[model samples]
Target: MEFRFTVLASGSTGNATVVQSGDKTVLVDAGHSLKKLEELMGSQGIAGHDIDAVLITHEHSDHIKGLNALARKYELPVYANEATWAALERHATHVPPERRVVMGTGEEVRFGSMAVRSYPISHDAAEPVGYTFTEDGYKLSLATDLGYVSDLVRRSIIDSDVLVLESNHDPEMLRMGRYPWNIKRRILSDVGHLSNEAAGEALCELMTDRTRRVYLAHLSLNHNMMDLARLTVNGVLEDRGHFFRKDEHPLRDTHPYEPTPWDQIKRKAL
Candidate 1:
């Protein structure tokens, strides 16, 4: 079976991704508006009905903005932990009870050929989590919107074939940016987002021989430029002697507005 992953949109503005294993398709977070979600998915030839489920990472607006409309329109099942569901219910009342699937952290849920599990993440939102999708022994993990990489987070994503990790900002740039002090402190907190340096260091520890692709996601438009993020990460990897050739371990970039090209995960030959 073919295992594929795509980032539909990723940034502070919004965040969403698509994970597909053969016939099973899952949408991870629907932060865009209903119209924008449609356009983003349509760009990748994925219609609403094509998605078998929606797995939420947290209750943050940037992660669940369009969830109500999308779930209601497609009659799709939405999964999240109890706290997140409780927090989300206050605003996304349009989502019916029958469509809500409250899952426990670290619990595995199957969607046909795909098996997905959520791992706890330290974000400012209620019960925020990251997801890992495993199919036919191949794994695709996504860990973004996290302030720092905890031991649990590191273990959860360790041997992934493809990883979509956050490279959110440059610390110095953020410290000097125009945002209010409180907002900056929130972002720099333990429950905030990860910086480029942190992401790079985390990658050095997380990357295994099985790891092939890494997508730098959720970049800040004001504080981070794509080239700067790439350069910083690569520099870190090189400095630590963990860097590999582009073909061996390609670092891909994701856009906040468009979908990344589908990345097929192929298992290594015995």
Candidate 2:
């Protein structure tokens, strides 16, 4: 069976996606309320009952905000690395034992016909990770909430068919943004967030002729303009003789993901 993926939602407001392959379906994260997910799925002619699992990247409220409620309602399994699991355990009380699976960093996990791998990222969180999902010959990678992309992260997502990458800010924008000094410092730290220039730099390492699409993700509503992020990444990628396969919505099936899947990504593979 052929696999398909769609960004149900993104941005700092909320995040989630729907991935399906025949009888198998997965929700990478569910920051949006169950009602929202239901609405998103319905818009795409999907049903919430079709989802089989939910994989979380970190314990941040933006990523886990609606997780417990969804888990309780659907009895869906949720996967995360040890440290992330521990961090979430403090708050994910509604999750039943059967629905909480502690994933091993850098190891491939099976969700029916799909294979998901979590790799460590540069984030301050306990064990944040970027995700790569493969089925048949297609691969989808999600990289967000990271400070930067290192050699390890580059390798984890390099050959992906579709990559949802974080373009969190523009250096100049962040420097001039209204965020307080301390918050600005945190976003610029090694474990903070990826700037547009940084995101562009990272893409240089991961782009390939095989890369069918690239989704710029986790855009800072306050610090970035879509045109700026798009142009920055495209220019950098162009320098590498690469460009986003933009014949479609950037990440929608007919296009795939959206303005950032709001999850915290840190490298575990490296």
Candidate 3:
């Protein structure tokens, strides 16, 4: 069976993505309210009961806001590193002890038919991390909420078949926008979100012909336009002689992100 994945929602307001390989279905984050999450999943023909686990990226409310509620309702397991667990335990009191699973950076967690590994990311949080899910020979990397791409990150996602990466904002738009100076500085800081230019540069280095899909995620609603982010990344790829097909829809247009078949990607692999 083909592995399945979808970015149910992605933004500052909330973030969540579903990944399924065979019987196991997992959610990457639950930043929205339980109700909103249900609505988003429902749109993709997934019910709340379908998820077997929740993998948290960090302790930020925008990523864990719905965690407690979702866990309580589904009796699902939640995975995170020690520091992130500590922070979540402090803030999300409703998650049951049995449901909290501790996973270290680079450690693989296996459930159902999928194997997921977490990698550390530079961000202002207790212990932020991105995840890579592998099934059979195919890999999908979800690396958002990162400040900048590190060597380890680049190495981890180098040959991924699908990449859901952050294109958080456009620097020019951000610098000229009305956000306060402190907020702007925080965003531009090394420990903050990745700008579109940075994301484009990183993708140019990471992407190979094997990459079948690329989703630009966690975009800043106020500082980044979807078309602009698409254009920027496309330009970078084209400049490097790696061109994405024009028929592909941007992540924003692929509402409930679905997995492209591994066979198709394999045929295009370099």
Most accurate candidate by lDDT: 1
Any runs in candidate 3 off by more than 4 Å, and if so which? 248-270
The lDDT for every candidate, in the order shown, is: 0.91, 0.76, 0.82
Provide the TM-score for each candidate, comma-separated. 0.97, 0.87, 0.92
Clashes of each: 0, 15, 0
Candidate 1, residues 1-270, lDDT tens digits: the string is 778988999998999999888798999999999899999999999999999999999888888899989999999999998988888977654578999998899999998878899999998987899999898889999999998999999999999988899999999999999999999999999999999999999999998778888999999999998999999999888888885766765699999999999989975554
lDDT score, candidate 3: 0.82
- Candidate No. with top TM-score: 1
Tell me the tens digit of each residue's lDDT in model 2 across 134-185: 8776788988888888889988989777788888888888889898999999
Candidate 1 local Cα displacement, residue 56, angstroms: 0.5
In model 1, where is the ten-residue run with the lowest total lDDT? 241-250
Task: State how far residue 62 of model 3 sits from its true place (Å).
Answer: 1.2
Which residue pairs come into collision in candidate 1? Answer: none
